[model samples]
Target: MASAIPLTRADMKRLADYAKREGVKAEVQIDDFIFRVSADHPPAKVDGSEESELDRELMEFDRKHGYR
Candidate 1:
């Protein structure tokens, strides 16, 4: 049985910030009803064009990772 753990607002906010800063890519189960956070995965080449700025940023990220 899975029991939900109550999280405080501060805990949730901190978790969100950590996810953003680390660019967390995925979560996978480690045990029954439990999961572990995975490292940031390699980004896929973006499709379509909308924001020039975002495109530029993605390019930069890829360049830094030698994915370009």
Candidate 2:
């Protein structure tokens, strides 16, 4: 098994600052006693087809489940 690695407060602060500058959101998770950080943002909506496909799928699912 791998060992846990510890980070200083300065390191965490730097990461958060960088994320804010880049317009990214940060997520932190804990596994057992370990902590991890992740940054994410909404993916670029490529084109109309991609968005239309998503909407179509949602509409179909809703119709199937009687959510509409």
Candidate 3:
């Protein structure tokens, strides 16, 4: 039995376009899409300022408690 795709036309179009561009079939790829959406992916970088703060925090943490 064929399953119904719950995605909207625009979403399917975007998926189809992306799949075509990447040379992949857009056939029932909802699982992969859902997995990617559900995963705990990292946040995107906006500015370079966060890098320095992160580095400083990491160094302070290491100094406070020795690195394993």
Candidate 4:
């Protein structure tokens, strides 16, 4: 298991400043100093045809039951 690291006020301020300067949003994880910065935009939509294993199985079941 990973240990969590506490961030000081200065550290948080610096990170916030950097994120603001870069014009992105920061997602910080305390357990692993992982920062995920993304632009302030809508997330991309997934294609409808890209089905997961569970989705495929459910579709097969539906077809067998003539529920389509």
- Please provide TM-scores, in order, for all candidate models, with all chains considered together: 0.32, 0.34, 0.31, 0.37
The model with the greatest lDDT is: 4
TM-score of 3: 0.31
Q: What lDDT score goes with residue 52 in model 2?
A: 95
Residue 42 local lDDT, model 3: 52
Error of 1 at 37 (Å): 10
Assess each prediction's global lDDT (C-alpha) against the native: 0.64, 0.71, 0.63, 0.74
lDDT of 2: 0.71
Highest-scoring model, TM-score: 4
Itemize residue pairs with steric clashes in candidate 2. none
Candidate 1 positional error at 13, Å: 0.3
Pairing residues by index, what is the TM-score of model 1? 0.32
Candidate 4 global CA lDDT score: 0.74
Per-residue lDDT of candidate 3, residues 1-68 (tens digit)? 66566687787677667765665554554553431122233577677688888988999999889873
TM-score-superior candidate, 2 or 4: 4
Query: Model 2: how far is 10 from its true place, Å?
Result: 31
lDDT of 2 by residue, 1-68 (tens): 87554656887788777776777755555455443445566687789998899999999999999999
Candidate 4 — which pairs collide? Answer: none
Runs of candidate 3 with Cα error greater than 4 angstroms are 1-45
- lDDT for model 3, please: 0.63
Q: Mind giving the per-residue lDDT tens digits that candidate 4 earns over 2-67?
A: 555577667777877777778778878866576555545557797767757669999999999999
**Deviation in angstroms for 24 in model 3?**
18
Q: After superposition, how far is residue 51 of candidate 2 from its true place, in Å?
A: 0.5
